[model samples]
Target chain A: MIFPALRVLVPVALVIALVAIGLRIGDALGIGPDPAFTLLAGALFGVLLQRSRFCFYCILRELFEDRDSRASYGLLVALAVGSLGYVAMFGSWVADPGAGRLPPDAHIGPVSWVLVVAGLAFGIGMTLSGSCISAHLYRLGEGSVLSPFALVGALAGFVLGFASWDHLYVETISRAPTEWLPARFGYGGAVLLQLAVLGALALLLMRRLPARPARDAAAWRLRAVLDAVFVRRWPAWVGGAGVGMLGFIAYFRTSPLGVTAELGSRARTLAERLDLIPGRLAGLDGFSGCATVVIDALMTENGVFILALVAGSLAAAIGAGAFRPRRQPLHRYPLALLGGVLMGWGAMVALGCTVGVLLSGISAFALSGWVFGAAVVAGVWVSLAVRNRVRMRLSARHPAG
Target chain B: MSTLSKSLRRTAALLLALPLLAAGQAVADGPVVSTSWLAERLGDERIRVVEVSVEPGRFERGHIPGAVNFRWHTDLVDPVRRDIASPEAFSKLVSEAGIDADTTVVLYGDHNNWFAAWGAWIFDLYGHDNVVLLDGGRDKWQRENREMSRRPARHAATDYQLDVAKPELRARLADVLEVVEGEHRAALLDIRSPAEFEGRIFAPPGIQELAIRAGHIPGAKNVPWDRVVRDDGTFRDTEELRRLYADIGIDGSDPVIVYCRIGERSAHSWFVLSRILGYEARQYDGSWTEWGNAVGVPIDNPAGTVWGGT
Candidate 1:
């Protein structure tokens, strides 16, 4: 038992030590302190997300299919905690919320029909691909074969999005209203409104949640401690709270908690180099949701953060002995590729993914966040319904099997 | 080897070196200085390097050694009003930044020296003849892996005075209006994006400062400011720039009025025309913000885009 625990503990300890040394000497390597801090924050977020199974698609699918709203509750708790944290930060930053001055680098974005379309596409993509973008990133560490295809498909989708960006920007996105809740309702009022909405959603979800199971008392021993550390999954609320705290600290110390900026930037750069996209992405730079730029620097905050996230997830997955690589059917690959394309296009048009736009946007009290979330839920429900019907029809035809 | 012969030889040597010295001074007095030129004279007493980036905190992160930061929002512009800094304020800023009448101020910044060009305009307005822009600015320097420092530059304050504000270099709303009404005989150069000039969008997609009306001043030629700079953020060669401007019929014959969404971008064009090409050009700093928003002003919106209209 001690030997197994040591195997798990050593790798995790080594990862932490390496991260510490990197942070200490980051400036010398042209990685500024801000990006270094982002790396730390991203790693912690990756661990929390993986341990709690905090995939938005998984959470929503479980709620709809199994009537298990436990993970949904975690998402709600995260939103509630994050909103409160944001309001506190906003209050200190802007004495008067009505002053029309927005906090710098928040994920507040424009609300428009394009955003809704993006959200819906993202939802359907998540259902088909079996995970959201951030989830796929962590699951890559868990040795998921589909994640790579999905991510690559997403890159291709970004190029497509860039190709279509001008038309969309000219038509509707240019005129879209960027609605910040704090601008109308004060910071306190905005946070209260968010909490109320989250609370009401929590109550609605609570009705469908399965009852809690009975727990057995266990002796406090070394084996039990080791098992809890290396085997047991963290509770939903614990992960939610941890994520919320991290979101606040990330925003306060660096920029917002976003993951798609680096990916989008890379895709944009690749497209530009290949001449697959226009020279200038029309009006792309002005909006704030994980804005992508033509890459000039060797390291960006988001770039380092993403790399650290994958590393951290790998470390955590290894410690838990959950790094299992399995082969999948050939047919599933195309589905993942298709799904990734949809998600990539959706993320680009929407200006972010679940983590950047939905989580960080909601935390910033942007109306776009809530609107995108609702649209995503609708898309998922509709996709799931269609899939179920197809499966039922196929099963009925093969009743002999 | 007599004393009289030795003195005669020395005089001849000094005469021979005069032309070389003057040629060197001519290069130093030009509108733009190369990265190598500035790099060699980083700590020279006569030179003062100023960084005026569009984005905040860029200077504090890492900047050229011995460069002082001048935030575009607070340091360059008027704190409250939508205008350039006043003469008195400019004087204080220059004096505090340790710039004197004779100091060769080398301005550089991010976004291809967009705000740094504006700084040069400001310095020019105050009759600082020795001011020049760092060619390619911060982008090129960083790309070349030039030395940078996080330490704030410290220089003893000088008693800099604003003696002559060059009104000829700045175009006001009335001047632009005259051009729009066909009363003025200057070339109206719109340096904003084509989408902006055509009224497809009010401003750049995410830009907060906007004009209610969308379009260019009637008859303004659309040559985006970015065309003047190479991919590396440096200005194009003189012959190429001449040919590019000549295609639009903006020869040195007629005075040119350059304008953009705001004044900063136009200042870049203003630098190219006035300083680089030596054209009789003026920067309409009020630009589209003043022209597009002003009621009863004539606008030629090619796209016919209306606010909140399908």
Candidate 2:
């Protein structure tokens, strides 16, 4: 009885304390109400994310590993919806598309072979770590032991990325052209091209929908709504819409929706404070990435959003009675750490993760997004093949076990 | 389970309170400003916004309402020599743009603001009073849904008096050679790509910016010029910038000389180091073109065993 009560009390206390702290910091910084609003918005996003399990890792895992693509449609819907939002915001600029003047700060990077390497590494990392950066944040709320390690590894990866960026940027990234679809095809053409591709994929996935249980003839449909909203799984379409709308709202209200930048920022700040990193990293401040430095390190818009995201997930998990901790083998911890390293490095080099690069980038009509997405899929396929081989080998060695 | 639950609740409460304990104002008022900052001060009388781009008509298409166009290649660069324009020519360019000595020129453009930084470096070279790079360049402004106009700006040309061109602001081939010979203890910053540092490929695959031989200056560290900025083309905060260079042993105390293929990319670094971080830094405009081609000068080729042939 006490444990159950503690769950409710703890999250409530956390929300109140966090809000108070956020407000205090905002006041101190003279940023007014921006931090508080972002905090609350982040919480909402977290709740939606937790309730729907809107994770890139899980979606891709199900698609490739389980031979199920139902959840994958959520991502497609997100892109489709997000692309429309971007079009609405960027329609005027797209009216005149020139090679020299592509839409700026849209997460579109130079299309290069490095993208394939980054994607492959990210896929391997996701498989090993069991979650993407965004997924890990929500999972941390539900008390996943592996998330913290993965995040730490991601931080380390960012540092490593900085170390190696000189070679990558000068050699590979500079060699390739930044391919923005709108620059070549114009805004309408690019949006239509993207929609057609996404729509076709969505239609194909719809045909492969999992069989649903027959409804009781006398039971009301509203009865199922509660289960969908609270206890049971949400339909792919609902999750898709929810995630899509959230992405749109995030971009509309603040900057692009990204989780890794904040992670990188905290890591860089901590490392700098500890004197672990260089006093001046050569040319690191200028290039565009999700991990741009913030004025208020502790109470940045992204930081608040990330915190609320975890809190929101915790709330949802407790409410749904799904906050139970899972038992795992000791070996999984080390493996997860290794996975985290790969994820951090991959995301750092790729300039964003699945959410930042694949979703947000494509939505902005950046060809780098398409390149990353394709590479990630290929990586996932390769990793699945390797996993299957390993599993088969293990079974062959110990048939009884 | 009860003990675990109790501890979890305590941890949650503590985590929530962490923000209140946080302190320090990480931002500093300096050369870089956000689109919002510039937007608020858009029509200020003392500020002059200059749109620098390689592409023609980019400013004509849409720009910050009052910004004048500065064609970096045609206007800033000397049409004759592979060098920045003469002081007299630069004076004419800025004076025509309605900028005087005290005018705070905010430079912004596309192409990762490379040309803008180049413009900023040129202004600093001639000792312009206040020159700044618009953080994230025009992209951030556009992304934020800020106001833009197609009307070409016209201003009363002022006789902007330029101070004597500071030769110390620039690193000549002789200075680079001194570092190469180990006579001077300075950080040689090669802002070129790694492949260029190594003798793998000459210029970027497409562009004509190339050297006769590949590789970096001896003792020069390869810190690609793009590393100093975020993906949106904004300079990183001071702390981040400090650690980035410190990590590479560029603590800003030692005199640093930055260079690239033809000095365009390195100019961006020079701006960041000298203007943003206040480092004792200089840009070697001759860069690889001079270093890579000059006879009898030592070159460090990482890709192959060969030194300098051509």
Candidate 3:
């Protein structure tokens, strides 16, 4: 009620943002990157995210508390479908094992354990913060109070991350390999490994479809394999495919789909200009390199891509007739701020978010995604425990406030 | 409802609604030309291409057949700061480049079309209705087919008409700063990376002060410029573009001021926001490069950022 229009408009707005991202990437590459294509895709995502109520937190919660994996199943299916598309288009990796350029920031380079710890931190932190990196990206579009804090915190965490780099690099990172996916399983093997692993997960979800009726309608997303196959109908799949296709096409334009590097560079630029920080943040620059930041500085590249994603999502929201923004209880603001800071910190420490580090990394056949995802989930759980105790204390005190 | 249900409901509902009218001209039908289209128009005396690349002399070293090098850092931008050239001076520069109201101009350069876009912004500002940025730029052209490079450019000067076309299209430094301060509620857009917005330190000295105390202009939003571009330096579609704007808090009436250090990068975003997606987007030509380093402007950077907004 506080921000009425925003509440009703948020989801759609977020979808539009993503679609615009696609279109912008399209333009950056000059590959007929039509805003229309991204627009429609955004609409589709809006519809899906809205209809399915897809939140990784909810999925994890169900899995953790109710022993339900329905939401998790849906997510896996989406990833499987999308990852297949990514590999099919780009192939495993460029030729010349030693020479070819891999996807930007996809692999966790020489920071294996640190990355794993970061991922776990993110996973758990997302739960505690009440949203994952990708979810927050869109949720902010929807006017979530906690979203801003999370974002701010992320920024703070990144700034602070500079302080720890020397240690992270010397003790934890220097000894590790950057491209674990390649080291463990050559390019071809890694691509195949993804298919095998995710393919298996997809099959497991398929088998669970029959038991859906036993669970509450809200709890069960689909009827396992059959519904997973047919329930979402063509639109959801199309929308998901569109995002995946956009991801594929993104490879042709600038770098593969990434959000963190851009965010990081933007953050760095602000710190320097505003004097919010010292002129330099120490080891971060050398670790990341100038080309990466320069690409993020591109006005028409990542900037437009993010724009398209949001705009496209908004359009999708409009088409499906579900575009509306809703304000959550204001009491959540402090928690939101705290949560945001943690997630932001985690994202910074880890070098990316779910979409940035995890998804992008996975697509590149990088092992860092695995590390970040797992660690973030762990962090989320830890945060959630803290929240539970706080909630209990609040309930004991005022019962409602 | 619990947070989960609330989130799910919001997501579902968002997937189900209708949006407002297309963000005014936020839906840009800006012309995108292929290398082929450029080649066809190359030799025509009426056409001029502007090479806007980042490298020191990328434009001077080689360019499209009949193109002129527009040094984003030097010519199109104010030497004092990232602010755009004054209108009178801007038009004269256009003419000096052999471009006119009727000149069929094509823009392209290295690093996708990032630099090239700054040139396009120049055209838009001066009301040169006949300019089009080469889609996919030379990088893509080189990939799909053979590429052409003009011999190093030769100096040519002509008396150009300092035509007053549309001064309103630009966002003055004051205007940008005002919006950033949340005075006019102008949607301050950082076309740079999140790091840049967060003051992660790496800003060139010229634009350091414009950064907010904490990070970002308290109310400013970020939409990295790369989001608008592709790997091969091409752009995405319109529908997608609209979505991108929505995601980044860009509303048609939001009064957006897009900026990057010297405004060259911001110009690229300016094109995307104003030209493609058709939002009332203006480029803060002075960007951080000027405002950040301005003598007495309010500067905010708390030692907590990478660039430090110093």
Candidate 4:
């Protein structure tokens, strides 16, 4: 009954409450707060994401494993639009200004070996966990009892991550530097290089041959075209571009692109405030806090956009009647849990996840993106190898999971 | 809508050739429900009340009628796996709590419903679609002058099914390690305090002899958990939640991992960001204890950082 008035009213009301609380807490903590507008946008995004399912894990799985690369369309659209917007605003934010490389926060870090390694771990983990970090949250909204374990596991990985810092800094990423940006290629060259790559990849991935191969595609389905107009549908090339653009726009708005940092950083502050976690870890006490340091963190326009994607998804899923709360398999939870652990550990090691390092990095022309992307593929393959070996061992004669 | 408004809408649709999509308010199953709605529902037999709480003994003191106790940690997970309970175990456990496949579990708890929503998260993880977290949880329930039962109720157990088709939803230890190593797909998030993050002096309650060097992972940022929730236990406004994350450098787009010491405190945050807020996020199960205890992994102490040798 109240849905009509609630949309605008709720957001406004929520905004008021948010500002009041933010100011109150900022004063007590003695930390200067960022402008409320950005914060409000972020909150709306949170609400949107919870409602939608704009998650990289969901989209990626749908693309590669399921051959249903529709969800990623929204991300691509976001990237395309955001990219143009970012390019328009890049000068004020960059050191060289002319380099198409707007900055680190716009897209992914760039191509790198470790990035691929970490991506593989995260990808496999999502397979096992049944929900990526973001999806895991929405699942919570719908009432899931198992997400907490992933949380516990992630924390453990972070703590354990301390044990691996030296290797991470030295062996894993001693040379993982930004790549592909205008800084390296110069403005025109960088733009041309990116366009060339995206165009080629899109062409190959989206090739269409005999319609008989895919029944869905065989039929002259108006739904596909309609979906393009209304919702995300087939041939996610355009969507991928959008996502890339969104990554571009994110940093142009004056902050880096990311998701885990805001939540993770907040978790740290909460633990400190409550005395649950020790006041120090990794030597940079105040360096990583949301109160004092915003640069190193990943929260910003992209955070809010994340929510918008979710909301957009929610709108689509609900509209399509495909929104059903599901029950995950019991036997597979061990794998899911372990996968989650790996994702946490890998995210810890890599300093970002697929969305941060791969998607954001790639869009930003950072070398880390390629590295993580490739690493993730390799990691998944390694998992396949392990699975193969495990099957061999478990069933010398008769095999199974 | 009025005739003029409807006419304008029609005109815009015909002229623009764009879908006139409308998204209603994102309604919770129950958002800030009144005390009366809750009271009436309490007597309904179809509503199975479950007290999913943090800490021990609280359920015994007083609880909603017919509610069973489910600890946020010990009762739901295999102490070692970094994800949700095994479906086999979850089915058995939830059933033991008297939850049937269709049972609508109305969960509540002590502080701002962290454990309660967490309980809800568990149900979702197990494929239960009918679970609900009581707004205000026990605190608001009590403040609203609702009744409480001091005696523990004798309840029956029911079955639950956690489908395995969605196994790709979680993050694993390797995933966390990858982030630490700066692999880059998804990053490990340390939602510990600044001190804990820096390895200055965090030994979660009983985690003595953390002989491992003290510090957070090199790239992990420290955002406390409660920033996601409010002081009164209700969730902060959506915008507040957004800013909280942004300030901490967390954008909703990237793959994110949230963690705390035992994951209980951090569970609150996981609930807020991933659950309530809907970011593609997961929680670290083992937390610091498991992380710091191992050798040759990774560690970042506070600025005065130190690492325990392998």
Interface Cα RMSD of candidate 1 = 7.1
Regions of candidate 1 where Cα sits further than 4 Å from its true position: A1-10, A13-17, A28-33, A219-222, B1-53, B56-310
Give the whole-model CA lDDT for all candidates, comma-separated. 0.84, 0.77, 0.59, 0.56
| Backbone clash tally (model 4) | 239
Q: For each candidate, what's the DockQ?
A: 0.04, 0.03, 0.02, 0.01
TM values, all candidates: 0.64, 0.58, 0.49, 0.43
Winning model by TM-score: 1
* Clash tally for model 2: 31
Q: Tell me model 4's lDDT, rounded to 2 decimals.
A: 0.56
Model with the higher lDDT, candidate 3 or 4:
3
Worst lDDT run of 10 residues, candidate 4 chain A, spans A285-294
Return whichever of 2 and 3 wins on DockQ.
2
Which runs in model 3 stand beyond 4 Å of their true positions? A1-52, A89-93, A96-109, A141-143, A180-184, A199-210, A213-243, A281-300, A317-327, A389-401, B1-310
Residue A336 in model 1: lDDT = 89
What is candidate 2's lDDT per residue for A238-346, written digit by digit as tens? 7777776777556544556677877777766666667766545544454444754523434566777788889888887776677867767887888788888888888
TM-score of 3: 0.49
Pick out the ten consecutive residues of candidate 2 chain A with the lowest summed lDDT: A25-34
Q: What is the Å distance of residue A366 in model 3 from its true position?
A: 0.3
Q: What's the ranking of the predictions by TM-score, best on top?
A: 1, 2, 3, 4
What are the per-residue Cα lDDT tens digits for candidate 3 across B1-310?
6999999999878766433221122112356776766665445555677777775434332356566766666577677853566677776777677665555677887777777887787677677766677788867766775545635444356556655476767777677667656677678787776766766664543333444333444456788888887676778787787788888667687767777766677777787777777777777776776666555556544446534233
Candidate 4, residues A1-401: lDDT per residue as tens digits?
A: 22444434544554466667445443222121123334433444434443335566666565655666455555555444544554444433343635343342344342356556567777677656656665554444334555555655555554444445446556645555545466766555665676566556555545422233444653457866554443334344444444444454434333444555544454455545666545544422211111111233344333443443344343334433334556667766566567667777666566666666665565555556656766765555455556657767878766453
TM-score of 2: 0.58
Per-residue alpha-carbon lDDT of candidate 1 for residues A1-401, written as tens digits (9 for 90 to 100): 22567557755785877578566745544343365687788778778877787889999999999989898888888888888887777765555768776666688888899999999999999988888899998888777899998998888888888999999999989999988998998877787788889989988988887878776467368887777665677777888988888888777676778788888989999999999997688788977778988886787778878877777777777777777788898878998898999999999999999888898899999998898888889888989999999889989999874
